[model samples]
Target: MAFTNEQIAVLEGAIASGILTVRYADRTVTYQSLKEMRITLRQMRGEMAAQVPGRPRARRTIRLYQSGSGNV
Candidate 1:
């Protein structure tokens, strides 16, 4: 499931507070300590960040001018 900004904030807070176990559906993930949780969170955040859509690039038009050339 995708996490909202608020939810991600809450998760970050919980990790800071040493609360590791996260439940989703019928599954649970428990980290050994805040350090482990931080590492996991960093990985998750990196993956999520990579998944975000970026702005489309603008198209460039190149104009070539010929000097004293009137060739059709």
Candidate 2:
């Protein structure tokens, strides 16, 4: 699920307090580990970046260049 900035803040707070449980309004989430929480935070940040206005999303690119010599 995509998390909002508020949700991300809550997660960060929990991590800062060394807590595994995060509360958001009426819902509460208990994470399995710090690794899980960190992963969630990273994902949330990435999502936030993707939602920025006029920002370019990651794209695939290809470039053709000459190698050493034509001999193989």
Highest lDDT model number: 2
State the displacement of the C-alpha of residue 17, model 1, in Å, after optimal TM-score superposition. Answer: 3.0
State the C-alpha lDDT per candidate: 0.69, 0.92
Model 2, 1-72: lDDT tens digits are 667889989899999999999999899889999999999899999999988999999898999999899898
Off by over 4 Å in 1: 1-10, 55-72
> How high is the lDDT of residue 5 in model 2?
83
User: Which residue pairs collide, candidate 2?
Assistant: none
Q: Evaluate model 2: give its TM-score.
A: 0.73
Q: Residue 32, candidate 1: how far off, in angstroms?
A: 0.7
> What's each prediction's TM-score?
0.53, 0.73
Q: Which 10 consecutive positions of candidate 2 have the poorest summed lDDT? A: 1-10
